[model samples]
Target: MPRTVSELMTPHPTVVEVTDTLHAVAQTMATQDVGSLVVAEGGAVVGIVTDRDLVVRGLAEGIGLDAPVGQLASEELVTVGPDDDLAEVVRLMREKAVRRVPVVEGDQAVGILSLGDLAQALDPDSALADISAAAPDE
Candidate 1:
């Protein structure tokens, strides 16, 4: 039987408002030990931001940490539904060149699906899966 996104996704992903500061964004990622966050506006999903976005789009551009997180967030958000198939998730990740994708239910972010999540579910013996399954460093 094929797997569904909800089966492999990390539920209740951390979220940040679009108006949040980049500094706050970084702090949240660090404290939560997550690589990405779902960006929201008016209680609706608007975009997504990753640690790489903080470095490449914000820091590398000399953008101030106090700047709004939207400055660095990828507004061209790619998302999936919890009931969607893993194949579709993989396709979107490939075409969009995104490692993380928010899983939504009626415009509300319910979870996050990441490449690492897929690796763990689909190829548990792979290095990526091993690393994904390992506990985070203290």
Candidate 2:
């Protein structure tokens, strides 16, 4: 089993500027086939935006797509280092009630560790692992 986040995390995760519009964020997510994006400012990770944010906080709230993504981005972001222990990361995730955490190296986002990554790496036989491993439906 992978012992550290670096071993299981999805590296080179898609990133977007905080000033990017919701429409841009949505397009990036669609193009990248990712549910979450690391929001950066001046090359530093500042926040994270998820597909859920687009719907619940943007569309449902009647926020126009032209609005900046920072409006819906979770600014009080939680992060982890690539070398952090997987167990500790899992604990932090549960405590923070967050599903995804950006892995940073001196303010630069190197990767993203997600619940799906944990499930797939730590328990390959689990249902979540199976689902996470399955290809996305077109």
Candidate 3:
């Protein structure tokens, strides 16, 4: 059987509502040790927000913590499904320059497929997977 996204994706990835405040979002990020989150509204993923977004768009712009995360999120979303082909997923990531994509099924965010996930799944013994698992010096 071919490896599907569901086979490799991180299910129930950390999520935050669009109404969530930046302060709350930052706390979630820190607690989960994740760099990004799927931005949801009405139980549907509407966008994505990264730790970089919090710094560049929220803090640097003088946006208060009370401000909604939606304001800083990228409403333009790129998503995939659990059943989709892994090759297509890789292509999308390469073409779109996106590191992560929320796996959605009928407007519901089911899981997340990340480049690291792809690397580990596709070539566990390869150097790319090693690089993907590496962390920068603190």
lDDT of 3 at 116: 84
Give the per-residue lDDT of model 3 (tens digit) for 51-119: 999999889999999999999988679999999988888898899899899999998999998888888
Residue-wise lDDT of candidate 2 within 1-138, one digit each (tens)?
789999998999888998999999999999888899999998899999999999999999999999999899996799999999999999999999999999999999999999999998888999999999999979
Clashing pairs in 1: none
Q: On residues 18-137, what C-alpha lDDT tens digit does candidate 1 reach at each position?
A: 999999999999999888889998778989998999999899999999999977778688889999988978987999898889999988999998889888878889999999999999
Backbone clashes counted, model 2: 0
TM-score of 1: 0.95
> Against the correct fold, how does model 3 do in TM-score?
0.89
Best-performing candidate as measured by TM-score: 2
Q: Of the pair 1 and 2, which is ahead by TM-score?
A: 2
Error of 1 at 88 (Å): 1.7
Error of 1 at 53 (Å): 0.5
Segments of candidate 1 deviating more than 4 angstroms: none
Comparing 1 and 2 by lDDT, which wins?
2
Ranking by TM-score: 2, 1, 3
